[model samples]
Target: MPSSSASPPPPPWLQPPFLLPGFKPELEPKIEPMNCPSGQLEPFVTRDTLLFTPPNPNTVPDEVENAFPEHLRLAHHLGASSNDHRSVISAPVVEVPAGPSDIVGSRKRKARSAEMVRASIVDTPDRLYFRGLVRRTRMTYDSLRYLLLTDDHGRGEAGLSDEITRRRKARSDLTAGALMGNRDLWLNRDSRIIGCIPGIRVGDVFFYRMELVVIGLHGLIQAGIDFVTAGRSTSGEPIATSIVVSGGYEDDDDKGAVLIYTGQGGRERNVAQQRSDQKLHGGNLALERSMNYGIEIRVIRGIKCNKSPSGMVYFYDGLYKITDCWMDLGKSGFKVYKYKLLRIKDQDEMGSEMFKLANELKQNPSGGRSVGHICLDISTGKENVPVSLFNDVDNDKDPLCFEYIAHSIFPQQTSQGAGSMGNGCDCTMNCSMGCYCALKNGGCFPYDENGTLLRGKPLIYECGTGCKCPLTCPNRVSQKGISYELEVFRSIETGWGVRSFDVIRAGTFVCEFSGITVTKQEAEQLSDDGCLVYPGKFPARWIEWGDISDASPDYVPAGFPSTPDLSFSIDVSRARNVGCYLSHCRSPNVFAQFVLFDHMPYPRVMIFAMENIPPLRELSIDYGVGDGYA
Candidate 1:
């Protein structure tokens, strides 16, 4: 806590958040602060005036204050000052409160009722073992959904009239989610509890509603609430398990740690205007009972994300106790029930809160990130999005002077002229499976309508310069250059690493791994130098990420594309882009994809996000864990 020096308060965004006693600051992510040219960091300070700080209640909307009033004000006053930012090590799984009660003087409590042990599932070995499986399942469903949307996006385009539309009326999200659910590919269906789901993290993100169903986060596909019926609850009363605050029913409030959630029904979504009085029969009653019982409920907030292929990102923001619930008159003449849910203490930072800050930074990098910006665009206008260079750790002005190159420089012999290409896709809009390039690439277009790579293959064929398809075609994602903002910052453990100013969604194309291409023999000789990137050594994480064959024994799935043999490696020792600076991790948030367009026979390594990545988290790839930095 800062000394009361009677100094003025910082701006709303810079206000410090209240720190829970045992939060263990060491759990925050370690970001190497760029030395402020003065050769040192701003001396730990009042915790309020840092460059990119944590969430401030003062910065949130009016609804949060209106709903959670007194407590929110207390949270703002208790705003914690931060020191270390260590995100690698997560704190313990949040502990749910002991026996809450639908009836305060129930005989069950007098007779010694059992404490909530179902949440202990989060700490069990079974949960640990299935954690990786859960991740794989979620990503697989998303990738399949994206692939389906590719075929379904162009409904009335010119081409074969006989071409069959796969999912015209039904959305791709529903189809992909349904396929995964029917196969029993998901876990935890037999039992649903009042606390955390096994293997799901607080900040983990989902792109589709069906994804929520498959992963057992939220059971219902469309309804806002997922709860246990009257007979199932310990008290013979319905109990709420989870609720999604989707800004649906404009009455709900989402201010990160504190949420003012609206009960389901009786209103126009987004408009907040009520159609009829909301009833307390099903989910609404469950929520009220849960509040009286003191049970914690999972809160997944859905925010619109332009970076997401599905145009929405569902963020799991830990558990929240329904502290209060009551009926209130809505803006429309009808009555509505609103629940006041407070986020449990000591969990991870809400990804949605961080997302808003990241968006602000992207909109005005100069204004939001007002300090420690070493070089604005390290690429010097070479790429579409600017790559920022920063070093706030020490006076060390590093990443030792290397020439910034946008595209890989291959030997003249490997290059092929555009007119020399043997083929290209002719379809103008969304390239159908019947297109020439689609067929040449084995069958389907490898990307979704939003330009997210559906799956990585031995070789992903894109419309080359000779192709009749426009540059904005869905298949032409990699060639667009870096779509989002990246920063080269110095870290304590890993000297120099790359991160993003934007919250990168899973499967979005990041950048191409570019450098001077070298022959196999040359790569072997320079390998000892410890800078050569052997594409052959890259793992099949992409294939594994898209693997859903284990959904059932009877589900004979289409085979994953084989890993292509590579005779060359990229020499990124000198000239490189943001991709070269990506650190190595066994479990990385990004993966390498093999793509060939202008380079036809030869493929360029394209980097893509593996999951919903929050801003300022160091970007990593599944390559050799060497020298810490890439």
Candidate 2:
């Protein structure tokens, strides 16, 4: 999946060390300089190879933002503001939409880019479309800054231009705003729209405001308001199209159904630092016109969400007609314009409100979401957050008796055994690709700050307790206990299954398969009786996520395995956690991954959300061949 050619023969779980002729197991071909990023082609790993790659070690964290500049505006997943900017040999297909008009790119490229952008927002299913959009946006942005801080190379800060360093000089909401703006990926840009966007549903959450920009939702990245000038409006008056209510203006009030929204402008960008009289211009004027014309403007509300990489999330709360508008004196003593936006009835429940309800459910366990909840916290005090046991289907008091444990229990013979593998990093805070730990993961960190797996790998090496990096380090994702609100609930079909009240974003860490580690022989004996969890049997979707072969055809896609090399399996019958209750399906939304923090011969079984999952949906995983109960 990584640039395996430049590196040593990757661990067995990865692609074959030698090139394949027609991907044959035999008949190794001679070397050739191909157009691949790795200078060799790649193919998906064979499913069986999962059984051979022992102690897979690519779970390291990405860029160390704590040790570098804080203002990286692009996607912040793997290395939030990744410095590992190794340039791709082939230039990225440059079909950005808002580049200099004077330089018209190829028409074919433009058409392809526009079509993909439109399809991403208007045609496909919400889960698939958003996942591809968000993933591609991050990958594109990461590539743009290629040749920045490399994994094995020296820090390349001195090589970056001022514009790249300053991150386009905007607020945090505008992460990757420039590329999406200048790139030719957008369509519906004529403005003057007054209704809901195609494909976008009410309560849909976005991690960045720039995502709102790319999908033709709200165009203004930094500005709170988006409007059509008087010349463009049908009524010959400035009119508003959409507005993002993110508490930029203190006068704004978000009441779920009724929003007492504040009109942008009047004060300096600095918080309460300067004051100015409101003007009847730009978005301010547009809001007034929209209110008078009874125009329903799209409203996306954003709030600080630590679960997101950008530390924020924007929820599309559907359309709201501007019912009232007026000039009002502001808290800073300057006259400001305000508008009352009334949510149109019969739309989906507001996403922000749902988020609020989910938070409440987490805090109100004893009494709620507690009516069916059997145990407020089945984990007792083991997990960082409690895992509730709820059974409304049948009167099951709790899951089969088992001791609650956080970390997987490894056999004495299988443990890394004492001396460190030197798998940790020296980073004081955020672990970067340059850290020794990252090198173990094929010269790249495996995750972003939010603990989202940037790319699926055979193994992910996290910053363990041996590392100087603090516990807050992003690399220590799997080590951290479950962070979401989960419940082990009984179902009519699946019996005991797991679900989440929180909207789990794609690639976010879910939980680990905590159990007593057993040898292969012991696992075989328990397989027929159930409760034997085999890490190698889970689907290896790394190729779908993005392998080096996607960039060029030089390398072959070999070793795309459904299984990974392993010496042990988990015996979850007598002792297990939430992961044991998860079900298996053909269209599963979750996947199992191999992770290690101590650089041991064995990796932990960490579960990650493979797609964006809405609240209360039963979580499922693919059992290699087809759908089956876990």
Candidate 3:
């Protein structure tokens, strides 16, 4: 009872701990709104407060609506008042079903995804470097995604589709549509063909072309350019008919896109300075060479049964033509030459032909790298002979060694009969008229002070062994082996050829043609059996006594049918020297001149350049035959 006034409740600020101590009630009454005449009312209790309006369950999707069965089920068993139940019943329920538009939207999303995948496949980087981008900032993954995932990419796709249609029309316009229609050329049971280019999607064997055959395998293959340097035709004739290079270096195949190389030089570059300098020279030179030469290259790919010790192995893929090429920054930010090639229609033919040739040459793949005589490297003074392959089958089978018969040659022989040997020359200095060999003809040496021939002339007989002059006599030239730096290399078209690293002037003495001295009869027999043989010039007396025509074949024995009226011939089918490699050409840079030095009954064949031969030029001779046959 005390404190009836409650001690005048402590002032609001100084009340008890509950009121004055800096404490407030944990729960507070929320203000309720009510309708009054003034349109607003303060906290007031009302029946509506206990019966609030609930959200309509039907507004949500079925999936979301199904997730709340407990909330919806409460309406059926509610213990609420009648008014509240009626309030719940008053709410409206709407059911909306998904329509065709929804289905179409979902399909559209899927189609976009598919298009994105296709674009990725088309633009996939061959080799991954950083990832998601090419060497330059020309394109990027985000941009690709935006373009491919939206109508923007679809516009491009439409353009491409139109282009595809155009290409298809072009293909239809081809010869009977049979050229590009045939897939049997490169396709086999093991691989499934796809797209215009069969192997671009899948790894396929390609015949890569390069400047150096030995190094091309690595460079072009690594760069994914399928091509192999083409050589001359089998007869050692230049392949001038087609702009395309079908196989390994064809004779005189150093033209056009044919010479385009990514690198400045080739594998044979030994000088450190030159190699270093080549690092910066863009493939511009190669590109220029290719364009100027109008060269076309053929690349092959196909599967074949390999009969090596390794069992059945697939060969190259189909053929492709280098259509276009240009320079671009590589993945490493360096200049890289890129080529765009198109598959050829005759891919099947090329594939089959290459396979057959490969099978034939499988036995001795290195060609002459390890056979016959030592491969003399002109770049390096090295004698590399494959001694292991040598045999004592023939005593005279000295492939590397040959005797230089030194005999006197006279233009007019009054005493000696045909092919009669002349006495030695007693020239203390250059051969003068006093020397018997020099009396009938000028000095046999054709080379001037610059080692180039001064002029072309008939057979100039040099002082031979009969001459008392030293081996250093100016009259002696053919007796010496190859004077200039020479390299014997295997040509894809021809079997082998002699090439030089430096340019050789006209009239330069290349090499002496020597082989097993076979009689004209023996040569014919060998030729009948598909062997290589060259006609030897006539004897000095025969030249003097008889009128010989360049068109006439060598003289054959009476028993044998009359062949070309050649005096003698050399058969090098079995044993030969560098001269055996000199190929034939219509407009040959070199010509054969008859020279007599020793007492040998037959005249020596000396090869001299008829024109200024550039570096890497393959010396050739006109065999007096037409183009078809070498």
Candidate 4:
């Protein structure tokens, strides 16, 4: 019995004895309890169990000893077998508090849901109010909806009814006023009015009508027309009756003024207005200027005159008598205007003999001193005897003087000089031979190479070779002869004869020769060579027959000179000298033509008949026929 047999396994709470003696147990010390509200001892309890116990020496591991609270660990013993029980252990748990934004988010979601439900229930009028607010505030539809719903509910309906009523009243008032004023406004103005009929609102139409009517009235006033009485109607109403009236006066002298009626209901009156005037007023200026001066023109004919030593003297009994000399008007065919002293009636007789001489000269070309013979009869003692005034006179010896005399009687006629071949006055001919022999034997041969007999040659065969009759021989033949009553003296040198009969009448044809020869240069050299020829040099005698040398040496052959032995005969002067003797006058009595012939001068003179002539007027020719050279 050593103490009931082995100490019953030493109590469980205690450490088993060390296997060897003298071993002591080490135990964790118990912690004291916290103060309790009831002042009772509060056992140390842990989350593992709701109980208090001793700590087991063997159950607590040595490593966990420092981490576990000494008060929280518990140990217990069961029986004598020494079984031990230990407390369970665990960590403590904690929780966080709720935030403010989360609580607000939940409340906002609930408010939006409530608002959606309210909008769905809204009527048309309420929706229109909301829409108007949106437009007015310039806000989004959602913001407008929120504002409406949140605002005082009863005020929205009352605001909408008041706005509608105000708009209606304003429009009604404007319409009534415009309708009443339209017609009066339109009738007063002058402009053409359109769109001013019935069924238009008064306020809408009144402004335009007033403007048009004002313009019309102003225009009528400017035109000086009375708009009050103008008869034209407007809008089926009388404007004067509808508007104010006034009175005005019009001038009686105004021709353009007219009266018009205006107004309505048979009560219209008249007014005067001015309008535009719409009426033109021709006469001996030229005739007055022409007759203002005293100058006059007179044309006279048949004047007769003569050249005296003093001057040209009138041979006719006319109002004007010659006191001054006569001059030519240059190349103008009309002679210069001549002035004269008035003749007394007693002096008329002094012109009678001169007048008779002029008449005689005009009646006969050869009736002047060159061709006429004159004698004076005288009584010696008591016996009536005729004194002979005639002697053998050589008129041909001074042919130039005789030619000058002929030209003086008729200024229109011309004469050739001493050496000229024209008119048979040849100064170059040998004077030793008789004029007839020189003409016949020396130069007047028929121009034949064999010396054949021709017109101006002596007819020797007819008279027998040596037996010749002076009357029958060509050399002695003459273009003049004596008559029974008078002795006719013929000239051999000049080929002129004294005859009792006149050779030419006034304006009669004189001796004419057709062939005229001219060189091209000479023909062109004359001043009026292509226009006119006045008789500057004409022969005093008209030759019937002559030799070439007895006539003009200026003569040229009729045809080309190469033609040999050609026997053509023409007055040499007619071919050369006569045309040159003629001077130029713009107005000429004679005309010329080219007469073609088989001669040295292909074109010859052919005088043309003229119209007007005066007594003792000179006969003229045209120089255009040739240069008067040949």
Candidate of highest TM-score: 1
User: What are the root-mean-square deviations of the candidates from the true structure over C-alphas?
Assistant: 16.7, 18.6, 36.8, 74.4
Of 2 and 4, the candidate ahead on lDDT is: 2
Task: Report the lDDT tens digits of candidate 4 across residue range 224-275.
Answer: 1111111121111101111101112122111111111111111112222322
> Candidate 2, residues 1-630: lDDT per residue as tens digits?
112123234222223233211111111111111111223232111222121122213210011100111222232222112111221111233222222232233221211111111122443365444444444544333322232212323222222333334443333223333333333433244322357655456776676545665556775444566664433332334456777777656677777898997665555423542267766555666676567556678888777776655566778888888888788887777787778889999998888887777777777855445356578788897888888888777777657478877788987764462244564566886776578876666655666545556556676667776788788887788888888889888899888889887888777789988888887877766644776767777777544442322222232332322233576788877788988888877546788888776635677888887655656668987767654642
Best-first order by TM-score: 1, 2, 3, 4
Worst 10 residues of 4 by lDDT: 109-118
lDDT (CA) per prediction = 0.61, 0.56, 0.31, 0.21
**Model 1 Cα shift for residue 129 (angstroms):** 4.2
Of 2 and 3, the candidate ahead on TM-score is: 2
Candidate 4, residue 265: Cα displacement in angstroms equals: 94
| TM-score list, all predictions | 0.70, 0.62, 0.32, 0.18
Better of 1 and 2 by TM-score: 1
Candidate 3: residue 177 Cα off by (Å): 57
